[model samples]
Target: MILIKYIIRNHIIPFLFACVVLISIFLLQFLMKFADKLIGKGLETIIIVKLIVYNLAWMVVLVVPMAVLVATLMAFGNMSQNNEIAIMKASGISLYKMIIPPLISSILIAILLVYFNNKIYPDANHAARLLMEDITRKKPTLSLVPGVFSQDVSSYAILARDVIQESNELKDVTIYDYSNPPKVNIVTAKEGKIFLVPNQKKLIMDLKVGEIHESDIYRQNVYRRLRFTHHKIAMPADQFTFEQSTPGGPRGDREMGAAQMLAIVDSINKVQSSYQKEFNSKIDQIIDKKFNYKPIDTTSNKYIYVKVEQRLRMLENGFTDVLNRIEYNRKEINRYMVEVHKKYALPVACIVFVLIGAPLGTMTRKGGIGMASGISLVFFVIYWAFLIGGEKLADRDLISPFVGIWSANVFLGIVGILLLIKTAKEKVTLNFEFITKRIPKSWKSSDDEIENN
Candidate 1:
C-alpha cells in the first residue's frame, strides 16, 4: 500500500509537469513558421489571442504522445536511479508489480488526453483554420498603404493614391482584376470602404463613386482592342473562410470530412480515367493500322513515331501514377476512418503505450531516467518512422492505411515482447550502442556528406 502511494506520488506528477513543458515548446515551434502571417496584419488583440489559442490545439494533440513518453521515462528513470525500483524488486516484489501504479496513472492521462484531443482540439483547429483564411482575404485591405503598392494576396492588385488608417478607407483607389480575359478590368474609386462578408468569410471593397473599365483585346483576331469604363462598379466577394463541411462529407486520414475526401477521390478517378482512355486510343491506332506508322518520307515518319510513342508513354505512366495516388489516398482515408472509431482504438493505444513504457523502463537497469528517456525516444522514433513510411507507401499506392498507422504499433509490440522476455530472466533488454554498431557500413554516411545534403 505504501509502495502504491509512493508510485503515484513520484511518477504521475512529474509526468504531467513534463506534458505541460512539452506543450509549451510545441506551441513555440508551431507558431514560428507563421510569424509573417501574424505580423503586419493589423489584427485586433482578441482576434490574435483567439488565433493563437486555436492553433495551440493542433500542437497540443501532436505533443501528447511525446509528453507521455518522456514523462514515463523520467519517472521510471528516477525510480531506478534512486534505488526505489531495486528496493521494490528486493522485497520479493516482481518487476510487473512495480509497473502497476505507473501504468494506472498513464491510462488515466490517456483518457484525459483523448477527451481533449477529440472534443476541444477539433473545434479549436477548425476555428483557427477559418480565422486564418479570413485574414488571408483581409490581408489585402490591411496591407494597403496610402502611397505604396501593397501585394498582400497573390491574386489581385490594388493601387491607392491615398488612404485613411482610422476607418481603413481608401482614397483615389484603382483595383485591377487579372483573372481572365478581358484580362484587365480596372476599377477607380473616389473613396472605398472595406467591409467583411456577412459570414466573415470574404472581404468586400465597397467603392463609392467608382468607375469600372473593361478591355476588349480579342474579337476573333481583330485584336486591336477597345476599352470601356463604368460608373459605380462593385467587385465580387472573396472566397468563404475554412468552415467545416457538412457532417456527411468524406474525410481522409488527416481527419478531413469523409464526404470531402470521397468527392476528391471521385475527381481524381475521373482524371485518371480520362488519361487512360486517351492512352488506349493511341494503342488502338498502332494495332489497327488506321494510320500508317510507315512514312514514305522517313524523317516525317520517324518524327511522328517518336512524338506519338513519347506521348503514349507519358499518358500510360500518368494513368498508372494516378492509380497509385488513389491507392495512397485510400490509405490516408483509412487513417481518418480510424477517427470514427476513436473511442475504441485510442483507449487501446493508451493501454499499449503504458505496457511498452513499463517494460522498457525496467529492462535498462542502469541510467535511471536517462536510460528510460533514451529508450522511450528510440521506440517512439521507430514508431514515428513506421507511420511516416506507411503514409509514403500509401501515397505511392503501395500500401493501405490499416497497414500504415498500425505498423508502428505492431513493431513496438514486437519490441515489447522481446524486452519482456529479457526482463523476466533478469537480463538487460537493450544495449544503447548495439543498434548504432549494427547499421551497415554501406548505409552509414560521413558527417560531411550528411551536412551537404
Candidate 2:
C-alpha cells in the first residue's frame, strides 16, 4: 500500500504540473492565431471569455496524453536516478509490479478522457463554431472614413468626402449601386446617414438632396436622371448579419458525439444503398427503353435515331448522377468514420504512452523537467505526425479509418512491449563510444585525407 501510494504520488504531481503547463502553452498558441479575429470586433467581454473557454476543451484533449508521457518519464527517471528502482528490484519487486499503480492511474485517466472527448468536447466545439460564425457575421463597427470606399453592403459601394462621427452622417456621399448588371447607377447625396436593421438583415441609407444617374448599355444614346429631396435605399445585409447555420439541426462530425456520428454513418450507408437501388433501377429502365422501341413501319431512320440518342443521353445522365451521389456518400462516410475513431484512439494514446514512457524512463535513468520535456516533445511529435498523416490518408479513401487512427498506437505499443521485455531482461544501454571504436581506421574524414596528402 505504501509503495503504491508513493508511486502514485510521484506520478500524479508531475502529471498535474505538466497538464497545467502544457495546456497553458497550447491555449496561448491558439489565442495567438485567433486573437486577430476577435480584436477590434467590439465583442462583449463575456463572449470573448466564453470563446476562450470553449476552445480549451480541445487543448485539454491534446495536452493530457502528452502530460501523461511527461509525468511517467519524469517520475520513473527520478526513481531510477536515485537507485530507488534498484533497491525495489533487490527486494523482489519487479519493474512490472512497480508500474502497476501508475499504469492503472493512466487507465482511469484514459477512461475519463474518453468520456470527455465524446460528451463535453463536442458541445464545446459546437459552441465555439457557432460563436465564431456569429463573430464573422458582425460588421467592423461601421466605420465609414472620409475619402474611403465602404463596401460593407453587398452589391453597393459608398464613398464619402466627409464623415461626421457624432451624427453618424456623411457629406458629399457618392453611392455606386451595381445590383443591376450591364448598367451603372450612381446617386450623389449632399447628406446621407447609414444604419443597419439587424432583425431584417438590411442596410438602409437615408439620402437628402440627391440626384440619381443611371446608364444602360442597351440604350447607349439615352440616359435616365432623377432628383429627390429625400430618398432611402435599402440593401440586403447578408454580409453584415450573422447567418445562423441550420439552427437546432445536426452538426458536423467534429461537433457531434459518438452516437450522433454513428447515426450519421448509418444514414449515409442508407443513402448509398438508396443510390445503388436507384442506379440499378435506372439501368433496368434504360435497358427496357432500348429494347422496347416501337416497331413502326412508317418511322424514318433519322427520327428513330434521334429518339434512341435522347434516351441514351438521359440514361447517361442518370448513371452519372448515381455515381456522383455514391462517391459523395462514400467520402462523407470516411470523414465521419475518421472522426469517430479519433475520439477513442486519441484517449487510448495515454495508455500507449505509459507503456513506452515507463520503460524509456527506466532505461534513460535521467529525471528533470528539461530532460522529460525534450524527450516528450520528440515522441509526441512523431505520434502526432503519424496521426495527421493517417487522417489524411483515411480522408482520401486510401486507408480505412481504423488503420489510420490506430496505427500509431499499435506501432508504439509494439515498441513499448519490446522495450518492456528488454528492460525486464536487463539490456545494456546503447553506447555511441562503442560504435566510434568499431569504425574502420581506414575510413577517415576529409581533414585526415587532406593531412595525409
Candidate 3:
C-alpha cells in the first residue's frame, strides 16, 4: 500500500507540472500564428480574449498525451536513479507490479480526456471556426488619408485630393464605381461625407455638387453626362460586428461531436448502400430487356433496335450518376470516420505513452528535465509524423480509417513491450563507458589539463 501511494505521489506531481509547462509552451507557439490575424483590426479586447480561450481547447487535447509521456519518464527515471527500483526488486517485487499504480492513473486520465475530447472539444472548435470566418469577413476600421486612394469600402474606389480629418469630410473626391461590370460610372464631387447606418449592412455616401459620367459596352458610341446639386449612393457594407453563429446547419467533421460524427457516417453508409442496390437493379433490368427482345417484322426490328440504343444510352448516364453519388458519400464517410477514430485514438495515447515511458525511463536511469525532454520529443515527433501521414492516407481512401488512425499506437506499444521485457530482465543499461570509448583519444581530459597547469 505504501509503495503504491509513493508511486502515485511521484507520478501525479510530475504529470501536473508537465501539463502546465507543456501547455504554456504550446500556447506561446499558437499565439505567434494567431496574433497576425487580429492585429490592426481594432477588435475589442474581450473578443480577442475569447478567441484565445476558445483556441486553447485543441491545444489542451494535443498537450495532454505528450505531458503524460514526459511525466512517466521523469517519475520512473527519478526512482531508478535513486536506486529505489533495486530495493523493490530485492524485496521480490516485480517490475510489472511496480508499474500498476501509475498505469492505473494513466488509464483514468485517459478516460477523462476521452470525455473532454468528445463533448467539450468540438464546441470550442466550432466556435473558433465561426469566429475566424467572421473576423476575416469583417472590414477594418476605416482610416482614409488625404491624397491616397481608398479601396476599403466594398468594391468602390475613392480618391480624395484633401480631407478634413476633424470633421470626417473629404474634398474634391473622384470615385470609380465598378459594381456593375462592363458599365463603369465616374463621379467627380466637390465634397462628400461617409456615414455608416446602424444595424444595417449599408454605407451612405452623400455627395454635393458632382458631375456623373456613365458608359456601357452595349452603348459604346453613346455616353450620358449629368450634373446634380446633391447625390447619395448607398452601398452594401462589410460591418465589423460579431454575431452569434447560427445553429442546425451542416458542419465539418472537426465541428461535430463524436455521436454526431458517428451518426453522419452511418447515414452515409446507408445512402451509399442504397445507391449500390439501385445501380444493380438497373443493370439487371437492362440485361433482362436485352434477353427478352422479340420482333414481329422488319419494321418492328428497326424500331426495337433504335429503342434499345436509346435505352442503353439512358442506362449509361444513370449508372454514371449513381456511381458519382456513391463515390461522394464514401469520401464523406471516410472523413467522418477518421475524426471518429481520432477522438478515441488520441485519448488512448496516454496509456500507450505510459507503456513506453515506464520501461525506457528505467533503462536510461537518468532523471532530469533535459533527459526526459530529449527522449519524449524524439518519440513524439515520430508518433505525430505517423499520425499525420495516416490521416492523410485515410482521407484519400488509401487505407481503412481504423488502420490509419491506430497505426502509431500499435507500433509504439510493441516497442514498449519489448523494452519492458528487457528492462524487467535487467538487460538494458545506459553504458556511458561504451559511448565514451568511441571518442578520439587525442581529446584532452581533465587530468591532462591539470598536468599542464
Candidate 3's C-alpha runs over 4 A off are 141-183, 186-200, 203-213, 224-234, 244-248, 289-306, 431-453
Q: Give one digit per residue, the lDDT tens place, for model 1 in 1-453.
A: 998897677666656776677777777776787766666556678877888888877666656666666666666656765777778777888767776886777678677866775567556656766677666554445467777765553456778888665576788887777767555677777777775556655567777776666665665443332233323333344442323233333322344433444556566567656656665665665566454345567746677787668766765676567556655645444544444333223344555666676666655544344555567667667766776777566555566655656667667767666665666458354456777688767566774477589
How does model 2 fare in lDDT? 0.85
Query: Which runs of model 1 end up more than 4 angstroms from their true locations?
Result: 141-215, 218-335, 338-347, 363-373, 395-397, 427-453
lDDT over C-alpha atoms for residue 432 of model 1: 62
Q: Write the per-residue lDDT of candidate 2 for residues 1-453, one digit (tens) a residue.
A: 999999999998899999999988988898898876777556788888988998999999999999999999999999988989889989999889988898899889999998999999999899888888877666533446689998867788889998765456889989999999889899999998876685847878889998999999888998999999999999887766755453355678888888899998998898899899999988888778744566465556776777788888988998999989998888889999999999999889998999988888888788788878988998898898889999999998899999999999999889888888789778334224665577777765763897689
The candidate maximizing TM-score is 3
Better model by lDDT: candidate 1 vs candidate 2: 2
> Mind giving the per-residue lDDT tens digits that candidate 3 earns over 96-162?
9988998898889889988988888888888888877677544422346678887877668888888
The Cα error of candidate 1 at residue 173, in Å, is 12
In model 3, where is the ten-residue run with the lowest total lDDT?
136-145
TM-score of each: 0.60, 0.78, 0.81
* Candidate 1, backbone clash total: 14
Error of 1 at 308 (Å): 26
